[model samples]
Target: MTASAEYLIALAGNPNCGKTTLFNAITGARQHVGNYPGITVEKKEGVHLFNGLKLRLVDLPGTYSLTAYSMEELVARDFLALERPQLVINIVDASNLERNLYLTIQILELGIPVVLALNMVDAAASRGIEIDAEELSRRLQIPVIPTVARSGTGKLELLEKTAEVAAENRSWKPLHISYGADIDPVLDQMETDIAGSDFLLDFYPARWIALKYLEADEQVINKGAEVNPELSSRLEALADHVAEHLQKTLETYPEAIIADHRYGFISAVLKAGVVHNSQRSDRLYLSDQLDQVLTNRFFGPLIMLVILYAVYKATFDYSALPVEWLNAGFTTLSAWMQTIIPPGLLQSLIVSGIIDGVGGVLSFIPLILFMFFAIAFLEDTGYLARVAYMLDRVFRTFGLHGSSVMAYIVSGGIAGGCAVPGVMATRTLRSPRERLATLLTAPFMNCGAKLPVFAMLIAAFFPARHAQMMFLLTIFSWIAALSMARIIRWTILRGPSTPFLLELPPYRMPTLKGLLIHTWERTWQYIRKAGTIILALSILFWALMTFPLLPDARKSQFEADRQQILSQLPEDTRTSLMQPGIAQDGLTREIAKASQRIRAIDRAESEATLQHSYAGRIGMALETLTQWSGFEWRTNVALLAGFAAKELIISTLGTAYSLGGADLDAGMSLSRRLASDPQWNRLRAFSLIVFIMLYAPCLATVTCIAKESGAVKWALFSLAFNTTAAYLISAAIYQGGLWMGIGG
Candidate 1:
């Protein structure tokens, strides 16, 4: 059904309520996650057909109150005021009745029909506490449905009540907290002033804004003045009068009175409706005991490390076989395509460019999927919150909030695989400075695209001894991130740390369905990006290496030189050169024949064209810049093209090093070739690895950073810093190696 024609149902609630779970259960696969019109905070919408009516459910971000202090509060208020959904499913936690009810009262003031879903009734009941749902329904003048959303209980009843409320088209009267005589006169005057103003229609009530103005809520005052200039001055006068009469500060008077009234109302309601048991139980005592240990000062970090290691080992070991199978399958398919298609540009495009480039990168999907699953499981089980608690002390020293530790850890493992969510996760930090600090350091983590480069380098340079080297490098990345985070925190994000006030959510068994869905969403993102950006870059790299082939004179001269050398060689030496040993004879002959054919083709091309073509000129330019680091022109070209996408490094190597063979691998592997080169050794290889590790993030990562941070400047800064770091480190390592006589 069209959006305009569908019945709109808004899901609104306080933070930590089961609103999200209820929304997910009701809508299932028909959900789209986005953001509010003008805010960075997330907005979720889902559509489902119930009783022949298409219900469009919009899940608003969680907020504590309708005070308009935070962006989320403003977005929630604006959506309710402007969009005016047909029904609001107000999900309130049964355990935290009073705090959740404050938002309910404010929402009721908006004159919208609300169906209360008293969620987490089971948790409350398990604690030997009970709420009379019927009494709550009567007192609030709304249909109250007690729900255990985690298990999908009372969902149908809740939906039925929501539809009933929507069909009735009823609005609840505003419930105002009565301020005593001291401030009542000022509130009345402000109300009159607001009612007489031309912009009165733009707001709910001038008295509410005036009350917030009296509380010195700068956000509300600014917004009110923007809507009606007269309102601000008049409200300011009213606030002054109230403050003077009450003998208190303007900010203190309103908040104190409002909170007292709210608590009083909640107390009265609880006295009438709730039954609390006195006895404590084994489960409660056990949970308390566990919390102490899990959130302990010492054990928490140790446990977190063990958990992280387990996740990595599981992802790496379990996915290795599947990844290998996928790579092998793609290789075989590419080889088959070469055999079917004659040796030409089309065959090169399909085998070397498309398959070896894109397909090679895509084969790592299983690993990505496994990692995402493990992350989702941790998130689902609520262990992530404890992780945040454990890292709070250390993170606070860096000027980052404790919550940012999770974002840093997640982003560090898989950088740009999906930075948007990593950035979004920063919302858990209360301090803006901490959030910005986390965002800046997040992309420094090695991402999935860099995985293939690391794998290739490790295989080539270290061989069977590579695992420990790989682990050391991974740890080094974290060390670098920690150091950078500390630097940025002190220099750029300097400020007082906010208090740690995170909620330790109860652990729940993770749902396999939800875990799988989240895993697939992230994995699908990687696949889509690889198909578009990575594939384009790979094809472009292939084109750069292929066109305007080698100079005819250069090729002929080299071939003639090689022929003369072979002709002059003794029969024994020639036999050794030509045939080699029995084991190596077949593969060596194939390579020799392929090299001869490439020479024949190069001899037919023009010198000027070969020199001026895109690849040659680009390589020449990079060679000038990279000479200090000892990179040959060809290696420079590959590294330059690799910035678009790291996987392209392998593809570029394949194309540049190809010897007119049916199989790309028939030529020396990029690793083997680099290792054998006189100019490169272990030291240069190590430096190159560090360069790749610290270089500018791929195109997708930069795009994600731009989108998430909402500034091109920050993305540019990340690129500049990372690229400079890579270059400086590589230069240092190379120059140091030369001084030590390790390499030329």
Candidate 2:
């Protein structure tokens, strides 16, 4: 189809209303659709080809209302007003039609064509609630298609109706709802004045603009003032007058009255033979019944802990073999490259830098996949929402919103999420102080990038206690994040905690298709990073550690030492040792001793060469302070690379160890090398894990924080603050452990 034949249709809905699910069903896209809110913080677009037409579908953020109270609401409202899509597919939760239709009424006010996708009809039926789509369509004057977005039911019909609506090219006709005797006259005057002046009429309908002014929406008010200051001021004055009148007579403001009437309108629509509930009104639904035990104060926390531990245990148990297979595969690849590629800079770049470095991170792919699968399952089942609701009580104690729990969870509070999305998720929080606090602290969660580092350390040192160590680390992360949030609130971002109302979506069994899609999407992102960003950075770090060759004198001294060992051997033995693939069993004792000595000399020289390099010097400089935490020069180099990305800690360590003569066996993995190193004890491994978990976030996340928070200072503060906290905690643990003679 030609570009001109394409129709732009926007998908709109309240949070948890299956809007994105329907979008995915239509477009065959795998956009992250979560059971809870705040997953789609920005617009995602995909195309659908039907017959001779191309339908460009845009999935807007899920928002409860069109008012500018949160970033989501503003984004949805702005896109509809400015972009003016050909039609909007408004998905509503059929089970909770009244609450979902509040946003629908606001969308209708925009005077755009809308086809109501009555999503989750099966869920509604399961709950014994029935909705007559035809009657609802007739009353609202819009096509209402009964749908179960999860199963792709009625999606074709919904698209057909959408195309029909677009083909009509219908004129924009705003829906009008009565606001009662108290405020109707004021709205009439405001709407007429707005229409007469043509103020914001290019973007918004006249009556919608008036309603925004009445609602005291900051975005619309600011835009109005910018467009025409005099008209905006007059409207503001009129709005204030009516607001005062309403407050005096009804003891309520215009915004509240408007909301009440909107809900009232929705109620009236449902009451007009549109919805029938077969279940008794007094009976509790399945969700509420489950919430009774799942959300119980005592039992909820216990269940959450048990579930989290179980996920970790299952991940470790199931993924162990695959992880080993991947590790062995990478090891084989590195070994084969070492033999095939000549011993030179090119060989070093491929085998050590690219293979070993990126491979070390990639080796943990199985673990990451398993962990992400568990998290996605929990999220899809709606248990994560319940977890958030339970966490709200603790979050409030730390001067944070209940909404912040999801941000932390996304940041890897459960162990396999990213911090960039987590930081952006804070935009859902209304309180600026709480949002900033959330943005700053969310990075402390054990994000997927850091998972490899922790997994490696725990495997090497606490092998038998894989799940236990991970569980402890998860707890430690929460404690550290919450403690830091408390400190932030007590000082710079201090404020009273705002009340939070968390909506718990009904629990549904996660489909195999959905779980696999979510898992693969996240797992693929990790793999892509290893191949691209991690690959590039690994090569760069290798260069930094490789250049500036050893002086000629130093090289000769190592050569002379090797020659002396060889010179002592008999002539035939020397010739035999020099031959390729000389059998160790065939060698005499004298020749074997000489060969071992020469190999030791090579290893010593390799270590010295690394110590003389540029990266080694920088690592040496930090060693003075890092020594307290048992970190030597090599670990320091890896940690420094971690600032760019946490996953680099593993890759850089791989390169560093491989280049630093840890090539005892060509196939030895990084974790094994660390376990065999005399310097890395259990205490030191635990200390390093703690430090890595709490250190500065990756560079990408730092930049996101700066942009999201609208300040460079906060980003800088995160860097300085997180590193300092990490150092202090790690140092204390290492020093205290030695004093107590534990894990020595």
Candidate 3:
């Protein structure tokens, strides 16, 4: 359908109200993502085709209110007021209808026609809330469609109703609500003055503009003054007089009164038999009952630990077979390449460079998938909020605002989260210092990107107790992050401590579709990284490791040794070996042993040539400095590449070892290759794991830190501090372990 012919319908709602689930159900994968105009808040738009009609669906940011308090709210407001969608589906949490209705009321106030999609009606029902959608719709003068977005219940009807509303081409009309007699006079005056001057009225509804002035919304006030300073000044003076008059007489502000009246209206609506909340179990819902223990002060922390450890156990247990299968698959691929590519640089490149490098990435796909699945399950079940809730005390102890807990949790505090969103989540922290501290340390969590490296190491060296090791590593990360936050807070970013209050969402059973979709989204992201960035680095490292081929003299020397060993075999055995070699088995065995020695010599030469190559030279330089930390040139290369991304550590190690390290029986995974090598052992493997975990945050995360902090110095500090701390910790463990005879 033509763009102009398509109807524009916007979806807006409060956070966590299943608004996104509804959008996904309506649009499926036909969605395009971009940023809202002049804001970093994401904008999701898609097209839904029904009966050959195209509906351009825009998913606006999830916002609590249409106030100019945050970027998200501003984007939601501007898009509705300026872009002017024909109809908006205002999704609300059916369980918490009262609180969710607050946002709905504000949206309706913006003069936008809204269809209240009563999302999560099942959740509301489970909580013993029975909403009369028709009664509520009558009161609000809008259509209300009960829905369970996750299951697509009522989705078709919601869309059909939406199309009908859009087809009506209804003219915009503002919803006016009376604030008590205390404030009506001032609002009336402002509306009259605003209408008289036509101050920003063509863009904003005249009465809404008056209401914004009453609320003292900065954006609206600025816009008003920019349009007509004289009129805006008069409006501002009137608002100030009302605010002062209210504050002095009633001890409240205009915004507070407006909010109260909105809620008052909502309370009156619900009290009119529109909602029948079942009197079940002392009016306590299932979530509240469970939270009594899950968020308990004494047992909560202990339970959280057990739950996290179990998640790791599940991850390792389920992924073991798949990881091995991946290894065997890589090995088989390498063997197939050997048969086709012939024994030379091209063959080596295919076998060692591309296959092994990319294989190192593919090997961890199962583990990453499992990790993401577990995390998604936790988040979807609403336990992630409890995780943050239980950790609030720990955060306060570490001198961090409790709001930082969610940021850390989002950053993979339990494991498998991303730092970008985690960094953005810190915007909720009122204290700038606390937010900055969170921004700097959130990356310390074992994000999904780092899971492969940790899982690979755990499987290789601590196979017997991979789950235990993973649990310990997670604990180490938390200890390090909290401790670092404390240090930085007390030193550079010190400020007043603020209380962090969190809303604990009701626990719900995660649906299979939700888990699979989340798991695939994150898993696919890792796979794409492997195909693009990791593949490029693998080939690049392979070139750096392959070129500067052993000089002619050295290559000839190895060939001469092979020939000399062949010449030493008895003549009878040589002819007989070509005939019935069993009759001269002893001599034939001698030739085979000599040939094995020659191949060993060739491998040694390859190792030497790799050491002399460009990347090797850099690795050698780093190796010298990192020797105390038990890192050889090969590990140094992997660790260096890890600064860009943790997955690169695997690809770099694969390329490094494929070119130089002791040759494995062809096709063994990188983990197996490292395990069989002399340089790697349990102690050194543990050290390397710690080093990679604690080193500089990945480049993308570092960029986020810098941007969030609005200072490059913090990013620089994170790099220098993380590397220095990682170095010292790794050195201490390696040296202390060696002293205690722990090194193999």
Candidate 4:
């Protein structure tokens, strides 16, 4: 349906309120995940058909209040005031009636029509608490529906009520409440001034705008100041007067007074039989009971490790079969093209450039998809919050807030996440220094883009212990991130640290349907990038690796060698060797050996040609410096491509090996090629993995870092510092291992 024709409904609530579950149920496979404009906050929209009309639901970022203390609050505020949805579905947790209603009241103040979904009714009943939905709805003058959003109970009625409310022909004005004797007169005067000037009144209700101004909302105050400096000055003067009066009277700010009055309104409503509780106030729920042990000081960290290791094992081990299948499929397709097309630059470009280059990255699709599913499961079950809670003490020792842990986890501390979002997650940190340290170090986590490279290397060198190796790598990434953060905090970015604070949401079993939605959203993102950006960069890097063919003299030498090998064999035996499979005599074996030798020589010539090409020259130039890290010119090439995007490390290696080492006709996986290559072995592979994990982030993440930190120098510093750090550490490991007689 056309967007204009569809009814726009917004779903908003506090974090962990079953809002997402309700959205998943109502939308059901019709959702799209996107970022809000100019920010990293995710915008999730879904559509549902209702009574011959279409309902478009946009899931706003979860926030506790409408006060502009965070980017989420601002984004939600803008979407409501500007887009002006017909109705908002405020999904309140029935179990946490008062706490959830805090957000509901914020939404109500926005003046939008709201249908309250008192979700988790069963959980509330189990706690011996009940909410009178009708009475609450009457008191709030909005439709209220009690729903067990998880079980699909009361979902239809909620949507039906929402549609009824949304279709009504009436204008919404912001909710107004008295803020007591001290501030009421000031608020009334500000409202009069706002309405008289018609300042921001078209978008926001006059009193609401006045309220935000009184709360010192920077966005609102700035906009007002911009619209009318004189009027804004007068309003601020009045707000300052009230702030001084309130501080003298009750020792608080205007915002605090406003909040107190809001709660007072809610308390009065609840006192009028709107809620009933028959159980003990401190009764332990299942989540609380689980938390007692799960979030223990000692065992919590251990259990987190065990859970993370299991996720790694599940992703790598279960994904092996599909990974192999995808590798084989791409190989087969490349082979088919080789047979059909005449051999030359066109055939080589199609096979080596497009197929092998892109296919190598795509081959890990199963692992990426599976990893996303495991992460989604952890997040959906609310264990991720507990993880951060448990890690708070660990982070504080290093001068980070508990909030920093979420950024690390989101960036792939557990594996299969993105650094961009991780950097954005630093917004939760109130301390600039801690946030900057996190922004600088978050890329060290093993993001999904780097997962394929690590997975491929592990498969090639550590095949027998695939899962264990991955688990170790994950731990190593965390160690590097935390260590780098500690070093950075203590030195360059050192400043006062913030106290630790965290909210551990109650644990719930992840719904299978919700897991699928989240998994598909992330997997589709990988597939999309593979089709577009990765595909383009693959072709570009292919040309860079393929050109500057061996000189005519060099070609003549190889041609002469090929002729000598052919001349040594009988014509029939040589001809038989040319065909792939045939009976072999003593003579045929000699001929086959001669043919294989000639093929190897030609491959060497191609390798030499790549060494002389533009990309090769750059890699070769860096070889002397990187040699200490055990990176040869070819590995140097992969590392260079990695800076553009980590996925390119795998693709570039695939192309590099495909060009000169393995004949496309052989159809071996890249891991097999690397395993067979004499230049690569266990020590060098480990070194490369270490370097890739700790080196500079992809260009996109660097851009985000620069934007978020508001300094290009920080991005540049990260590039230089991380590269230097990764090189030294890798060199140490490689040199140390060599000295210990670990390599052949």
The digit string of per-residue lDDT tens for model 1 on 1-744 reads 233446888999987687777888888888876656655567878998876667899989888877776667878887887787887999998877887888887787566788999998887776676888998888777889999887889999998887766766665445666676666677777767766874444556555655666677776677777876776777887787777756654445666676677677767766754546545655564345677887788887677666766666676678768877786787678667866887667977787678777775687788778878887788767787777777788777767777776776666443324444466567667677777777767666666666666666665667664445655666677666667778877787678888887777666666666677668766776788779887888888777767766567765776676566567545554554432122334545645554454444343332233345577678777877777676766667668877777767766665554423223243244555556556666776777777877778767567767776678987898888888877887888888888988853
Per-residue alpha-carbon lDDT of candidate 3 for residues 1-744, written as tens digits (9 for 90 to 100): 344567888999987788777787788768766666544567788899875568999988888999867667888889999989998999999988999999888888778889989989988887677999999989999999999988889988888888778878898888889998888998888888878877897778887888898899999999877889989899899989999999999999999999999999899989868998785757777788898888888988888899999998998899889988888988888778877776788987788888888888898888889989998888888898888777888898877888898888878787788777788788878788888888888888888777888887877788799889889989998998898889988898888788978777778776677677668767877788899988887887788777777788887887687567667887654443322112323445667675466557766877888887887888999887899999998888788788887888888887787777434346567777777877789999989888887889988788877877888998999999889988999999999999999977
The worst-scoring run of ten residues by lDDT in candidate 1 lies at 659-668
Model 4 C-alpha lDDT per residue in residues 499-570, reported as the tens digit of each score: 887777777887898898889989998888888998889888888987777688987997788778888877
Tell me how many clashing residue pairs each candidate has: 0, 0, 1, 0
Best by lDDT: 2
Put the candidates in lDDT order, highest first.
2, 4, 3, 1
Each model's lDDT? 0.70, 0.89, 0.83, 0.86
- TM-scores across all candidates? 0.81, 0.94, 0.89, 0.97
Which stretches of model 4 miss by more than 4 angstroms?
1-5, 571-587, 662-665
User: RMSD to native for every prediction?
Assistant: 5.6, 2.9, 4.0, 2.0
Residue 366 displacement in candidate 4 (angstroms): 1.4
Worst 10 residues of 4 by lDDT: 579-588
- Runs in model 2 deviating more than 4 A are 1-4, 29-42, 571-586, 662-665
Best-to-worst ranking by TM-score: 4, 2, 3, 1
What does the lDDT come to for candidate 4? 0.86
Q: Give lDDT for model 1.
A: 0.70
